[model samples]
Target chain A: MITDFTPWQSLGGGALIGLAAVLLMALHGRILGATGILGGVLRFADMDDWRLKAALLVGMAMGPLVLLALTGQTPAVEIPISTLAIVLGGVVVGVGVSYGGGCTSGHGVCGNARFSRRSLVATVTFMVTAFATVYLTRHVMGV
Target chain B: MKLVSALLIAVIFGIGIALSGMMNPAKVLNFFDLAQIGAGTWDPSLAFVMGGALAITIPGYWLVFRRAAPLQAPRFQLPDTKVIDRRLILGSATFGIGWGIAGFCPGGALPALGTGEPEAFLFVAALIGGLLLARALETRGLRSKPAI
Candidate 1:
């Protein structure tokens, strides 16, 4: 029934995420959704400017390295899925975020925070689908 | 000034994600496990992260808006679209499946580079490819409704 819980870590991490979102909104008047940030990189013509977004993306790529140097703590990531699965998953994720309008940051954080009805629906839809996919893949298909 | 702040905040965000253990794939996968759905089967710790983030952000937004303009920028950029439609659902559903399969969303995927795993890089590459593909499609007039 029950297993592991890291209330403090989750809460704190979430707090940081919140802080980032709020700070970005507060200072820059923008949302910090990663997909949007990345996607915006390509549509420079329609956008007002791309410097800030590009900076954020660069900072994102380098931030973890900075964190590692500071805390000497390594990120814990394990991917045992097949190459095909990962590739397909990555492609779909790319398309999905593009189609859906945002990913975790956009929909789950800023979008919902703004009380955007579309965001709320999008968040619920994705979360539920993720849960179901996991169930089917893990429980049913045994993949 | 804006440039520095952008990088500073993003770096701070990366630290938070790392500290939060979101950079860990196993931990995230567990969060999505149906076996751990409710009380005890799995971990719901990550949900708290979302809660914690909202606590500050929503109010922060209100506070910031009180000012006529942003600190360094000329004006405020916010999302104003308000239509819920088929595309949103279908797009979200597809994104959800991808997330379930990899246990890594765009947010966490970047920090995943910290792990120094080749797979993470490959995933990022593929993700970029997908984004480019989406851009290509949209440029060809195949957009759903212009996400932003």
Candidate 2:
């Protein structure tokens, strides 16, 4: 049984995410939704919002970087899909986030945390679609 | 006291992810495939992670809800609607499909990317694209509402 259970590590990771989200909300009045933050960068709207957006993006990018620096652990598995396929996946997710009005962090973390009905619906939709897709990809198409 | 407590709770949440191996993309990807291969051989590590998270969060939620004033937000924000509709169903379906194919949902994926997996980057990109398109459509709909 090669089970990996590290309560301290997991707790630390979750704490970072929660702290980031909380700080972003408190300081910037924006939820730490990665999708939204990335979208803002791509669109490059008014100048006023740029600083906060940039900060959030850096914070996200830095979170993992900092962890790597401390732990020195790297990913083992090679992604099976092509770069094109991966980018296509990104586009699909982007479209979904747009229509849903929130990404997983917004809907799953903050909105759901607030117990918003819309967030609940969105989160469930996200989860179910993900399950079905994985099943089909791995089982049916053997991707 | 409320703000301090919220921050402390947030720290606990981060620690849980770090300890549970949920921060690792490979581990998470494996969990999604567990049902297909056979639960017997599946890695139950994340299950314990989930359990621990729930154990901590359930009580946390209860304590926070019991408060007269929200610690973080200006007021307590609870779900306003219980009705399920087409938007809910459709959105959920789309989200699940994406998660299944990618093996990364928004919350877990970003943190797991700390492992420097390129796939995580790809996932984040696709997620952003989906969100932007949705927003565009919404803006269009709002504009045409009065005309219709």
* Interface C-alpha RMSD per candidate, 1 decimal: 2.2, 5.8
Model 1's TM-score against the true structure: 0.91
lDDT of candidate 2 over B1-148, digit per residue (tens): 4334333333333333444565454455455565635645454454454344334433445455555654444654333555566655555566556655554555555544555667777777676666666666667875311100
Cα displacement (angstroms), candidate 1, residue B141, comes to: 4.3
User: What are the Cα lDDT values of the candidates?
Assistant: 0.79, 0.53
Q: Lowest lDDT 10-mer window, candidate 2 chain A?
A: A1-10
- Model 1 chain A lDDT-worst window of ten: A1-10
Candidate 1, residues B1-148, lDDT tens digits: the string is 8878888888777777766757665677788895865536688777887888788778877787788887777788777778888888998998999988877788888767756777778777888887877767878887464463
Candidate 2 residue-wise lDDT, A61-94, digit = tens = 4444554566685323345555665666666665
DockQ of each: 0.64, 0.29
